[model samples]
Target chain A: MKLLLTGSAGFIGSHLAEHFLAHGHEVIGVDNYLSGQPRHTRHLLAHPGFSFVEADVSMGLPTDTGPLNWVLHFASPASPPHYQQHAIETLMVGAQGTQHALDLARRSGARFLLASTSEVYGDPQVHPQPEAYWGHVNPNGVRSCYDEAKRYAEAITCAYHREHGLDTRIIRIFNTYGPHMRPDDGRVVTNFINQALAGEALTVQGDGQQTRSFQYVSDLVAGIAALMALPGPHPHPVNLGTTDAITVLRFAQIVRDAIDPTLPIRFVPLAADDPRQRQPDITLARTLLGWSPQVSLTDGLTRTIAYFRALRAEQQPVPTSGPAWMRGAADAGQSAATPGD
Target chain B: MKLLLTGSAGFIGSHLAEHFLAHGHEVIGVDNYLSGQPRHTRHLLAHPGFSFVEADVSMGLPTDTGPLNWVLHFASPASPPHYQQHAIETLMVGAQGTQHALDLARRSGARFLLASTSEVYGDPQVHPQPEAYWGHVNPNGVRSCYDEAKRYAEAITCAYHREHGLDTRIIRIFNTYGPHMRPDDGRVVTNFINQALAGEALTVQGDGQQTRSFQYVSDLVAGIAALMALPGPHPHPVNLGTTDAITVLRFAQIVRDAIDPTLPIRFVPLAADDPRQRQPDITLARTLLGWSPQVSLTDGLTRTIAYFRALRAEQQPVPTSGPAWMRGAADAGQSAATPGD
Candidate 1:
């Protein structure tokens, strides 16, 4: 099968591109690199099954991208700080960008998969949000650029499916972390990991009691692939994330133990409208796609720490005068303040 | 002031256009007549202050209609049945149509007023929703086309305001009814008035216990005009409706009493995702714009009934065989089966 994947240079997108290539599918990747870094997909650039295009999907997709069986739209800034910085861009990508992808899918007779987010359920009133839950979201809040745009995207996707009989699937992704994450992405996982690696104070917000369920990137990619392989167009949205819940402090501790156990913890004020907890009820994924997250938090953190460590090593040569582990610690600390999800 | 008002042929828009014209403003009215009727604006065609442009704002605005001092985006199917029928169009008008209006506003440096609805606070958990209440909405439900579209419109309106420094105001309009409403618009006011006028049984949904605060169109127009006259951009959303809440059964009784006190009511199942109760907290509108609804329900219902009666009389020639009041009763009964709101 051939696929057109957007945001293919970002963490989740790049990983999904790799997963598709590994499964013997040809992939055409597109990214304008607004929040995505080219280095994330540098290795995949030379793969025989992968080809890349530099373009913003919000404007339009390339015309020359040949026959496609799938169109995966994951083209917006996922983290709060990034989206807040590029608020208008985020809104456009969710609205126009999704429209472009859906139009492409409709024209090519391809299955369209929208990478919707758990943020759609903003500071959710319901626990372990199910696909059936009608979210409690502020349509005009600071986070609305991302939350409302995603909601609009879902609405339009359903509209196309109902009006034009276009094949579409919506995956509401929860907190996902692993390799390829930007060190300063402003999400809790990357924030804690980078702070721990640098031996700096790990910042937890508002007593750090707020909880989240993190899904490993690989698990999310697997769920996406499974959903894509299903027989017909599944118009209903499906929750794709691990059910295992953990407090923010516990998550920070796991990262600290894996990287630097001696790192001090710092408490900070939480951002306005920050969710207290978010856990997906993925019964639909289990029943229909027969998928569940397999990566344990401990293993995921270990592999992620190894990746960051190797990244630091490559950026700074091992020093003969001081401890080799401390060579890139200073730079990591400098850039660790911008944590991402 | 020169104003570009979309949906100018619809019930509220027509009244608003007249309001602006009466205040000595030059008005350029645009409508595609999707849910709006041409007959509603027939009187305004010859008005020196008003000019009509037949175009869908969702597609694009007329370029030649120069210099807009204010852009009022009021283009969408408001009533549930009308919106549900044109679901895709409604979504596009809210998303793409809103974008077009904002772009126009930004380019012309005009104040943009978004006609958002109380449906943004979908099936509210709060009794009287305030501007501060983050809405509880279903992103993929049947009514999501209208609710989420309005939410997206608000988000994008704020986006344009923050990003381009475009002056913007959002009014969360609650249930409103008056003259020029389509007899079959499927709102409770029109529904009950039409049924009562026809001397047919008024159908009340779900024991008629659900409550909605209905604002008269003239009061909404006054509030909109006051907001438009404010000196600077007020980006905050304001709730613009009455606090006088009444149950659907009570509302039906008022309509019946005005048209025909002997009219019976039939109970029926409510529509999916219908809000059991929705009343706006207009504290912000009162403080910011000094606006409040002044039309009593009884007076509004009487005027609405008179309008429908006149319309029925015009459409069907009254026979001399029976009393003049019973002349148009047969047609009203024939078309009163479909309940609205």
Candidate 2:
């Protein structure tokens, strides 16, 4: 199989590209480093089947690419601070970028998959959100640039499926964390790990009772591979995430224990519109794809912490890192806007 | 004020065009005739202050429209059947068309007013939705093409306001029925009026107990003018709709009585995802803009019916009309996707 995978240097996108390439699929990776790292692309560049395009998907895909098989749209600044900082660009990538990808998929007669986020659920009213639950989303909030854009991407993906008979896939990925994640993308998971490793107090926002369901990236890629392997026209969005709900404080303790047991955990005020609890009802994924998260929070955090610690030893910073909103946010490190708390 | 308005040949666009023309503003109107009527443009062409540009906004706006004080983006196929059939176009206008409009607004240093919709609330969990209500919307549902598009439009509008410091105004219009609506735009209001006048049975989808707020176009125009008249940089969206909630059955009876009391009424199964009740929480509009609906239902229905009657007398079909799905949707004649149930 051959594929055009966008945002291929970003956290989840890079993982997805590697998975496909390892499976012997010819991969054309695209990214403008809006929030992606060069290291990931540089790593993929060593692979024989992987080619790269340095372009913004919102502008348009490369015209010369002889495409076949699939088009995966995974571009956009997914982190809260990144999207908020690049608000218009985020909206454009979701709106126009999604359209351009769909158009390419249609022209190439390739299956299309959009990298949607659980943020579509907003500060969900339902504790465990089923794909059937219409999301509760604020259309003009600070996060609207990301949330509404993903919702719009889902809308247009369905439109392409219905109108053009295009085979389309939508995955509403929940909070996911793993290796290859930036050391500081403003997500809670990374904030805790980096703080613990650096001997800084792990800052827990609010009382830290708020819980988030975090899926390991390997598990996420496994679910995607399963979904992609299935036959055509499964356009309904599928939720892929761990069902085990972990409170932010508990997760913070786990990260601190992995690095230094004495790392302090301090409480701070919670951010506005922060969800009290968010977990995915993954019944459909289990029933249809025979998939469930295999990696536990402790194991996932251990590996993620080791990766960041190694990067620190190398004296290299995370690539394309946005503003330093993370210095105090010992929150969920699953910040890449890819999937989050 | 000199202004640029897209969808000028549209139902509400034409009304808005006339409103500004009467106020002595130079208005350059753009429409691709996708869902807009040439006759509406013909009427406006006679006015010295009004000019028409034939173009699709999703493709791009015209280059020759000199400087502008305002950019009003009101384009798209709004009715359920119309939008569903032209699903891709609707998505483009809301996504790309909106961005294009915003770019021009930024370039001209003009104020931007986005004609959003109450449908953004998407079968609201909150009755009389306030501006602060986070909507319950199915991101991939049938109506998503229109609902999510408008939601996307609002997101991008806010992005422009926040990012480029572009002055922006957004009005979430509710069910507005008045003159210049297409006879067959498949909205509940016009369905009853046209059915009654043609001596056909009024088709009420369901027991018709579902209620909807109906605002006359004049009241809507007045609210828009108010929002536009405000000083620089009020970026938050304001609801510009009538708060009087009217049941579908009662609305049908009103339209029937206005045309002819002898007209028959029929009940059928309700459409899926149809809102049981919807009305605006207009406290903001009243408090901020000193605006309130002045047109009573009886008076508004009578005026609307008279206008359709005159159109029928002229023996000219509503121009640039789409499919004929309005035959049984007596749910609202306030079709055309401008604003409806």
Number of backbone collisions per candidate, in order?
10, 20
| Over 4 Å off, model 2 | A316-341, B316-341
Instruction: List ranges where model 1 is wrong by over 4 Å.
Output: A63-67, A317-341, B63-67, B317-341
For candidate 2, the TM-score is 0.92
Q: Which 10 residues in a row give candidate 1 chain B its minimum summed lDDT?
A: B332-341
Taking the tens digit of each residue's C-alpha lDDT, what string does model 2 give over A112-141? 999999999998888799999888778888
TM-score of chain A of 2: 0.92
What TM-score goes with each of the models? 0.90, 0.92
DockQ in order: 0.65, 0.75
State how far residue A10 of model 1 sits from its true place (Å).
Answer: 1.6
State the lDDT of candidate 1 residue by residue for B55-143, as single tens digits. 99988997776677899999999999998889889988998899999988877778999999999999899978988998788888889
Q: What is the lDDT of residue B333 in candidate 2?
A: 30
Winning model by DockQ:
2
